[model samples]
Target: MNTTEIFLIAMLIIFSLPWLVWRVFNTDYFAPLVVVQIIMGILLGPGVLGKWSPEYYQFVFTPAVVQSLNGIAWWAVMLFVMIAGVELDLAQAWKHRRESGITAGLALGSPLLLGCGAALVLLQFPGWMGPLAQHWQFVLGIGMACAVTALPILILLMEKLEILRHPLGQRILRYASLDDIAIWGVLALILMDWSRIGKQVVFLIAFVLLGWGFRRLMAWLQERDRWYVALIWLAACGFGADWAGLHYMVGAFLAGAIMDAHWFDQDRLDQLRHHVLLVMMPVFFLSTGLRTNWAVGGAEVFAAAALLLFVSVAGKLIGVRIAGRVLGWGPGEASVIGWLLQTKALIMIIFANILLDKQVITSETFTALLLMAVASTMLTVPVVAPRMSAHR
Candidate 1:
C-alpha cells in the first residue's frame, strides 16, 4: 500500500482497537479509556508488536508514515500541555499558601529523593543511562520523573469520581498545580545546555518581554480571536524554545502558563481540552510506544519499573501522611488524597519523553518509566474510589 493508505491503516488501528477493547471488556472501573489507550500504545510499539510480527510492523509503520504521525502527535501534545498550563489555578494555591505549600512540598520532595536513590541504583547497571547524558542529568531526570503527577490525568480522574468541583477536589487541584510549576521548572533545569547558555538566557529574557505584550494583546481580543492568537503564540514559543536548545515542550508549557485561565470562558476551554485529547493525544501515545525498546531484557526493564513504582507510590503516600498529621486532617483523608496525588500518567510520560529525546535516558529506561506510568495511573481510581466512598 502507499504511504497514505498505510498511515490510514495505522490510524484506524490506533483509534479502533483500544476503543473496542475498552467498550467490550468494560475496564472503566479499574482502567479508564485513557489508561487503556496508553497500554495499547505500548503493546503496539516496537518492543511488543515488532517482536511479535516484525514484517507487519515495518510495513505499516514505515518511515514516511511514522513521520506523518509524529507531526500530529507533536502538535496534539503541545496543545494539551498548554491547556494544562492555562488551567493552573495558582491564585487558589496562593490563597491557601501554608497548607498548599506543606502538601505540595512533601508530595514532590519525598518522591524526588527516593527516585534519585533509585536512579543511583540504575546507574550501576548498563543500558540505563543514555549516551549523551551526564551523570547528574540522568539522576535528576529520573528523579523528577518519579515525582511527577499528571495534573491533566488527575483532573480527568477527579471529574470521573464526580469531585472536580467539590471542596476536596479543589484542594487536590491546588496541590497539583503548585507541583506542576516545580515539575516544569525542573525540566527546564534538566534540559539546560551549557554550550547554549547564551541562547537560553536570551530566550528567557525575550519571553518575559514578549509574554507581557502577548498577555495585553490577549486581553484586548475577542474570545474567538483569542483562540486563534493563542495557537499562533503556541507555535512561536515552541519554535523559540527549540531554537534556544530548551526543547519546544518547555516553550509550549510557558506559552500557556503566562496566560490567565480566567481570560477564557471556562466551558469552552474545557471543551477544547476534551476535543484535543479525543482527537490528538492517542497519536502521541502511539508515537511514544514506537520508541519503546527492551534491549536491556524484559525482565530487567520490569524490575526497574517495579522499583520506580514502589518508590513513587510509597513516597507520595508517606509524604502525604506526614502532611495530614501536621495539618490535623480528618481520618481517611490522607489515603484518599495520597492515592489521587500518586497518579503519574500523561505528565510522567511526557517528562520521560523529553529525557529520551535529549538522550538523558535510554529507550530501556523510557520503557520502564512508561510501564511505571501505566501501572501507577491504573492503581489510582481503584484504590481511591473505595476510600472516597467510605467518607461519603
Candidate 2:
C-alpha cells in the first residue's frame, strides 16, 4: 500500500477511537480518556495483533507517520508547558506562602528524592534496557522524569472541580507551581550541564543572559511582531544548540519560558492550547502508543516493569506523605496530593525523547514507560476527584 493509505488509516483510528471508548465504557473509570487513546495505539502497535502481521504495523506506523506524530506531540507539549508556566500567578498564591512552603516541600522533594534513590539502585543492574548510563547524565534524565508532576493537568483538574480559587486550592496551585519550577530547574540543569564543556559556569551565565535579553527584546515588540520575532529567535536558539555545546530542548524551553515571562497572554496561550488538544495532542498521544514496542513483553520484563511502577507509586506515597505533614497539610490531604500529583504523563514523553535521542533506552523501554504513564494518569484523576468534595 502507498504511504497515503497508511497515513489515512492511522488518522482514522486516532480520531475515532476516543469516541468509541466513551461509547463502550458506560463510565470512564477503568477505561479512562487517555487510556482509550493509548489502547488505540496498542491495537495498531507491535503489542498484540500487530506482531502477527508486521505489515500492518509498518503501514500504519510509517516513518512519515512517526515524524508527523513527533511534530504534533511537540506542539502539544509546548502548549501544555506554556499553559503551566503562565498560570503560575504568584500574586494569587502569595497569601498561602507558609502552607505553600510545607506543601511544596513534601510535594516536590519526596518524589525527586525517591526517584533519585531508585535511580541509584537501578544503576547497579548492569543495564535494565531502560537506561544506558554511559554517563550519569542518562541516569539523571530518568530520575528527573520520575520526579516530575503533571502541573498543567493538575491545575486544570483543580479548576474544573472549582477548588482553584479556594484556600486549599490556592495552596495546591502554588505548591504544584513550585514543583514545576523545581522540575524545570532540574531539567535545565540536566540539559545544560550534560555537555562536558569547558568553562561550564561561564556558559551557564551566558545562556541565562541570552535568554533574558531575548525575553526583553520580545517584550519590546508589537504583539504581532513578537510572534515572528519569537519564532526567529527560537529558530536561532535551535541552531545555537547544534552549533554550540547545548541541547535543543534547552533552547526550546528558554524560548518558551521567555514568551511565558512577558509576551504571551495566558488566555491567548490557552486558546492555542485548545487547538493543540483537539488535534495536535491526540496525534502526539497516538504516536507514542504506536511507538510502544510492547512486543518486547515477557513475564520477566513485566516483573521488572511492575517493580519499577510500584517503587514509583509507593515512594511518592511515603515521601509525599511525610512532606505533606511538614508542609502543614493534615495526613488526609497530603495522602490525596501524593496520589494525585504523582500522575506522570508529560515527563514520559520527555524521557522517551531523551532516551531515543541519546540511545540510552530502547524503543521497547520507551513504550513500557508510556504504558506506565497512561496507567498512572488513568488511575490518579478519578481516585482524586471524588475526594475533592470529601476534603471540602
Cα-based lDDT for every prediction: 0.95, 0.62
User: Which parts of model 2 are misplaced by more than 4 Å?
Assistant: 26-32, 89-98, 120-132, 188-207, 222-235, 242-246, 260-265
Instruction: Estimate the overall C-alpha local distance difference test score of candidate 1.
Output: 0.95
Off by over 4 Å in 1: none
Per-residue lDDT for 26-134 in model 2, tens only? Answer: 5465445555665666566666546778876676778886787777676566555544555565654567677666666666665556656665665565444444335
> Each candidate's TM vs. the true structure?
0.99, 0.82
lDDT by residue (tens digit), candidate 1, 215-334 = 999999999899999999999999999999999999999999999998899999999989998999999999999999999999999999999999999999999999999999999999
Q: Kindly give the number of clashing pairs for every candidate.
A: 0, 2
lDDT against true structure, model 2: 0.62
In the predicted model 1, the residue pairs found to clash are none
